[model samples]
Target: MLGNGLLKGLTETARNFFGSYVDKDRLTTIQYPEERAPRIEASRNFPFLVYDGTDPQAGLRCVSCLICEKECPPKCIFIEKSTDKKPDAVGKPQFYPTRFNIDVSVCMSCQICVEVCPFDAIKMDNDFEASATGRFSDLLWTKERLAKSNEYYHHIHPTEAADVDAVLAAARAKAAAPRPPAPSAPGGAPEK
Candidate 1:
């Protein structure tokens, strides 16, 4: 009648209110901490190292290439290559990150670290609950803290991890293949 326009809004509000009780999908509000939303495969927050096997340091795929650290726009990543080489997940004896650290307080979460890493060691984590009480110690996460199992990486990003794993397996197979011996000279003398 007089308030036909207002009546429509009121009717919608009533419908929404009743639907919230009956319809499982009608609830729009998500209770934090207790009720977590569905995981988004593409979502990323902070950078974490991906390690395979039981040992985090030895199994780390980083290879101390420093690509991620160099590409980080904020310069939040710091890494020190180990002098001693260790067998990595891909069966290559490579230098590991002895002093890898990330200033999470200054990290912008641009995901450049994950993108520039050639070894697939770095990936962005979906966990956004990195609260720090102390600035220096708490905010600056070391290699041990940042390291996560390969399974964790797969859990967070199944498609990306699968692609990376395929490349790693190929590399390992190539490295394992026997190299052909060098050819000898015309007079049966080995080439210098």
Candidate 2:
């Protein structure tokens, strides 16, 4: 019986060993660079910010709230708010950030900045091609460099982008629609 068990184990091991070569056509592992790998969709990653290029004030979404800056654990965000001119207009604080910078060298890609932004101004990009040599400033990205077209975001994440656009469209429709007249009180009672 002991010998039979050992023989069975050997047979199973040999089968597994030879099976790989036997089914080699089904294997899909490709050598990097020599063979191109399949591309991953952007929604596989967490959300990030994007700008709408056709809008002249695309960057206006980032109200200089500093919420993202405060929430950033790496302290990579640097914002210089502009001076406030008007005091009474329900205006967001006038501090237009003269310099908004994120040091890619220190970024952990946590998506915290994207999460806390009330304006939905910032989002993560699928682009991972940022590589350079020498100097910390070289790694620091400015607002201009970070701004990407909303169309680009839609291209990367069609489903999610479509959902967001649908919500915006519904909100615009609701805002533009006329309000219904208030219902009269039940049994002809005077309306409050």
Candidate 3:
């Protein structure tokens, strides 16, 4: 009983070692640059801001609500709301983030920012190649560097992006729908 656990671990190691030689499927190691494993759809590395269209500044989905910044466990997210308002994706006048930065060195890739964002403006990017020589300055990603188009979001996360698009379409439809005319006051009200 004492060495059973150790024996099991050893057995697994031996099996894997022998299996790698016999079975190609059992081989886990790959040449780093030339050959790489297929990326998992659910894999997420860091946070990036999602924008609607061509113009990163004008089409930004983030309303600069500061929710992500407040909710981030590591306090890596920073945002500065703009003084003037800009029309968001839904054509509503909303304050856009004038200054947004995320310190990747400090961020733990917890996806809390993406979860807290109500506007669907923030999403986890699968780009894991964020290595930098300098820890502080090089890793601090700015709004410009972090802004990615909706198409890119769809490419990285198809299912989730499609769902988000459907919800947004419904919202847009609701906003565009006409309102019923206001009823006039009782007949005699205007008769002096």
The number of the candidate with the highest lDDT is: 3
- What TM-score does structure 2 among the candidates reach? 0.62
Off by over 4 Å in 1: 1-3, 21-25, 180-192
Give per-model CA RMSD. 4.3, 6.7, 5.1
Q: Which scores better on lDDT, 1 or 3?
A: 3
RMSD in angstroms between candidate 3 and the native structure over all alpha carbons: 5.1
Between candidates 1 and 2, name the one with more favorable TM-score: 1
Residue-level lDDT tens digits of model 1 in 1-192: 999999999999999989889997988879979988877999988899989998887788788888888999999999998899877765767888899999998899999888788777899899877887887899999998999999999998999989999998898787789977877666877756
Task: Give per-model TM-scores.
Answer: 0.83, 0.62, 0.78
What lDDT tens digits, residue by residue, belong to model 3 across residues 1-192? Answer: 899999999999999989888999987778878987766789999999999978887888999999999999999999999999988765789999999999998899999999888889999999877788987889999999999999999998999999999998897887789976878877758755
lDDT of 1: 0.88
Candidate 2, RMSD to the unseen true structure: 6.7
lDDT of 3 at 121: 94
Candidates' lDDT values, in order?
0.88, 0.67, 0.91
Q: How many pairs of residues in model 1 come into backbone collision?
A: 0
